[model samples]
Target: MIPTLILLGLVFGRWWRSSLMAAAVGWPVVLVATDVMSIEVGLLGASALATMNAAVGVVVHQMILRMTRQLRPAGSSRSGA
Candidate 1:
């Protein structure tokens, strides 16, 4: 789930190649930090959770982008204040 959130943030928030590179870099860090190789595999439900997490990430990022654009000060002006 967390990974997919990162993936969507990378995809929707950044460029495509950056997204891919982030996944490539992040996965290994997670793998090494967690060290799950010694455990047996049984986390099959992760795919479903990942999907939801990604959706949430995309939505939140899109909203933030939209809000930032809307909040930007209109036109250029001198800062004589």
Candidate 2:
């Protein structure tokens, strides 16, 4: 799901927006799941996980995008070579 969300971000050329969207969607789901399942969870722990998830998704997506750009043919439109 993280990868998919990142890909969606790439497709839309707005990785930051997608990263924030994932966090927005994920935090609430985690909160609800924890509550409905009667699981003992701490706010700090859940928040940490959500933050890590968002950071990883954005970082990885950017890295992949960078690699793709570097690997493209130099004469490609974006490369302007």
Candidate 3:
């Protein structure tokens, strides 16, 4: 789940989209897994957890991107100029 969220964050490159996708993907599994809670409760809980995890993933992805950008050589250029 963690890896999936991180991958989504990196792939999507947007926090909101990654969070929404995480919630959508997690909600069904959570709804089915916890018999102790009502559907509504499960949904809320799952959505919250998914959103938080995705946010963290997005932060991690952004940090990695920043670090990589900083590490690149100043002379490197994508353009032929």
Compare the candidates by lDDT and give the number of the best one. Answer: 3
After superposing candidate 1 on the true structure, give the runs of residues whose Cα lies further than 4 Å from its correct spot.
1-45, 76-81
Per-residue lDDT of candidate 1, residues 1-81 (tens digit): 386665566456634344444444554455556875332333223333444555555656667778877887776455845
The predicted structure with the larger TM-score, 1 or 2, is 2
TM-score of each: 0.42, 0.52, 0.58
Candidate 2: tens digits of C-alpha lDDT, residues 17-77:
6566666566657677767423345644654555555666667668888999889887779
Estimate every model's Cα lDDT from 0 to 1: 0.53, 0.60, 0.66
Predicted candidate 3 versus true structure: per-residue lDDT over 14-68, tens digit per residue: 5657466756666556656866445665666666776666677677777888898
**lDDT ranking from best to worst?**
3, 2, 1
- Candidate 1 least-lDDT 10 residues: 37-46
Model 1 C-alpha lDDT versus the unseen true structure: 0.53
